[model samples]
Target: MNQQHPSMEVMCHVHNCKFNENDYCFAPKLEVNPLQGSGASNSKEALCTTFQPR
Candidate 1:
């Protein structure tokens, strides 16, 4: 059976991101993308696409 994850509040710690508001992610949505050719093999290979430099 398929299961869906529940939505929860997002917390942000990146001070340079434009969406960061009071240590929280103020973006309406967030997306994580792979930065490698064959997809992310590890956490280091992924990027927060919602980041906008302040």
Candidate 2:
């Protein structure tokens, strides 16, 4: 069986990010990882691994 996921808005503030268009993320896929290998304790400690420099 195939599953379909609902689309949602992804807001971005990094003007230099390649996938950022009009303050929104347009990447085909989004990847978020912990800033450190250990783990993220808060939102600030997490990082967008899918970020690409424009």
Candidate 3:
């Protein structure tokens, strides 16, 4: 299938990130993971640190 944004890429470093050298995210889909504590209080509602937008 064709993607809407060809330049868009997503990655996930929460536990086991699946990003390669080509900046491609191999995750089947994006999911939300609940955070614990105040470390990421100032961040967005959801975190996708592994995401790399082209």
Which candidate gets the maximum lDDT versus the true structure?
A: 2
Ranking by TM-score: 2, 1, 3
Poorest lDDT segment (10 consecutive residues) of candidate 1: 4-13
On residues 1-54, what C-alpha lDDT tens digit does candidate 1 reach at each position? 899765878888999999998998988789989996759889899989999999
lDDT of 2 at 10: 96
Model 3 CA lDDT for position 26: 70
Write down the lDDT of every candidate, Cα atoms only.
0.88, 0.93, 0.49
- Model 1, stretches more than 4 Å misplaced? 1-6
**For each candidate, what TM-score against the reference?**
0.71, 0.83, 0.30
Compute the lDDT for candidate 1. Answer: 0.88
Candidates sorted by lDDT, best first: 2, 1, 3
Residue 42 shift from truth in candidate 2, angstroms: 0.6
lDDT of 3 by residue, 1-54 (tens): 977744447543333344443444675555444365535555564565444453
Q: Number of clashes in every candidate structure?
A: 0, 0, 1
